[model samples]
Target: MIYSEKVMDHFQNPRNVGKIEDADGVGEVGNAKCGDIMKIYLKVDDNGIITDVKFNTYGCASAIATSSMATELIKGKSVDDALQLSNKAVVEALDGLPPVKVHCSVLAEEAVRAAVADYYQRKGIEKEIPGCSGNCSCCHLHDEHCGGDEE
Candidate 1:
């Protein structure tokens, strides 16, 4: 399994690695088959900009790298813009990931959407999470995050 240099760098030095005690929103996702679990935290300003982002991941190098890159992509972006983030973009930002490890990027994307959904829910906003594929097991397990009926 060849990894990109960016992927290795991120794996060795994962960013935003801890939980935020006062996070405005939080999201968790896992792939039981691969045994990867990811949690994302966000602090959004009242103006709808993401002031900060963090993540905790337990898996292989790809999982940690993808989680780190996802945070970097969303921080300082508008909530709406952050919601537009996609796994393909994450993969591209990382230079790329091996075909088999691509699922880690999907987890990163889902984690971001889940955290934003939590933020919206906390603000009493009734809105659908953008970019939700509704195919991840996390969505079926945590319906509130995806706003979809569990499969």
Candidate 2:
């Protein structure tokens, strides 16, 4: 499967590849289908802004690229904004992804959301998952909320 130029660029030079020491929130998730894992670190301010974001992903190139892209998108953004970051947006930000690789973006999206969830939990606040469950648009069976576009 062919990847977009943006995907290759980010994968080759992944940003925020390390963890934040004493981070305010941390999230880790694994893709059961691929057996790949992603861990996200976040430093949030009192105002709920994500002052810093970083990720370490053990997966395919798309996983790394999507992780980098997700950090770039959420850094300096509010926790609510970060929660709204979608897998489709991740794929779009990377120009596009092969159908089979679409789930990598989903992993990235979930990682950020999980981090935000952790943040709220620390404050003794409960919040719901902001977006869809991320079934992935690439699969014909799950295209309803998955948004089968560009792919």
Reference-based TM-score of each model = 0.86, 0.83
lDDT of 2: 0.80
Candidate 1 lDDT over 7-78, as tens digits, reads: 999999998899999999888887544468889999999899999998999889999999999999999999
Off by over 4 Å in 2: 31-33, 131-151
Error of 1 at 29 (Å): 0.9
Write candidate 2's Cα lDDT for 1-151 as tens digits.
Answer: 8888999999999989999988988887764344467889999988989988889888889989999999999999999999999889999999999998887787788888788888878788867766533222122222343343432
Candidate 1 wrongly placed segments (more than 4 Å): 131-151
TM-score of 2: 0.83
Pairs in steric clash, model 1 = none
The most accurate candidate by lDDT is 1
